[model samples]
Target: MNGMHRLLWAFLVAAGLAGGLAGCASTSSTPSVGVGPDGKVQNPVQLLGQLPLPPGAAIRAEQSLIIGAGDNWVGRVVLDVGRDFDAAYRFFLETYPAQGWTVVSAVRGKNSFMVMTRQERTATFEMVDGGMLAGSVVSMTMAPRNAAVMVPKKP
Candidate 1:
């Protein structure tokens, strides 16, 4: 090929590579479909809402998790509800027992905490007086009662 044709070919090759790289520089956090049809972040912690939370409680979409596997499951769910400290605390106090949990400990006041255990599982929740805006926040964590701190590594 002639020198001019070679120069033009090089320019075209460089432009193609630059365009490909520019396409890679996406500004979106997600590759596609960040929001569902409902306009909320998809793949949310659905486990939170599915748990036996009281009516009107709103689970914090992010500050929740599910851990462990099968019969050894542990999890946490944080909720905000337009309810006073006493009522919310009382709900947990009463709810756990009806579900067959034995109340390990219970306290009542502005910021109260309760611990309940059933079989090999333990559940604990702390009720704060107020949230950043609404009424109160209940943070609850559930785990196996006698979970080992650490286990030996498998071969």
Candidate 2:
């Protein structure tokens, strides 16, 4: 077509692109939803009022889900421990009891596991060592504590 028509067509295409991008951009009145701008829980005390988390641990929200809130929460919370596996392992070993969790079972290795109980609930920790660079991943699952089952003695 003529130069004037081509110029008008280019301007229209640029305006359309700008409008589309503006539509895609989101602006919120608040700083964040459930988490802070940094993706960490905005209020850990409100979310995990009772449970103790390792220092500097980042919650993997995409991989984590919970029911209830605060001290009554249940479900799995996957954490990216910014330290090595041993550190994360010890953090739970030390913190759980300090928070009133009685250790039912604890095993340490390349892939560690620990089970703890408090009041009417139980927590299971599945830990994995992610080598030197990747740090460790701690998957904590909390549920209601079960009643003990009796077993017969062997003759």
lDDT winner: 2
Candidate 1 local lDDT, 1-155, one digit each (tens): 76543543354445446544765695644223243453333433333332466656765646755443223335665777565666677777777688788998887767788888988877788888885455898878766576434333548
Worst 10 residues of 1 by lDDT: 41-50
TM-score of each: 0.59, 0.68
Regions more than 4 Å wrong, model 1:
1-50, 68-73, 131-133, 150-155
lDDT of 1 at 109: 68
Compared with the true structure, what per-residue lDDT tens digits does model 2 show for residues 1-155? 76543543354445446544764685623223277676666555555657878888888777876554568666678888875677778889998898788999998888999999998988889999989987889988776575233343558
TM-score of 2: 0.68
* Segments in model 2 whose C-alpha atoms lie over 4 Å from true places: 1-33, 36-40, 147-155
Worst 10 residues of 2 by lDDT: 24-33
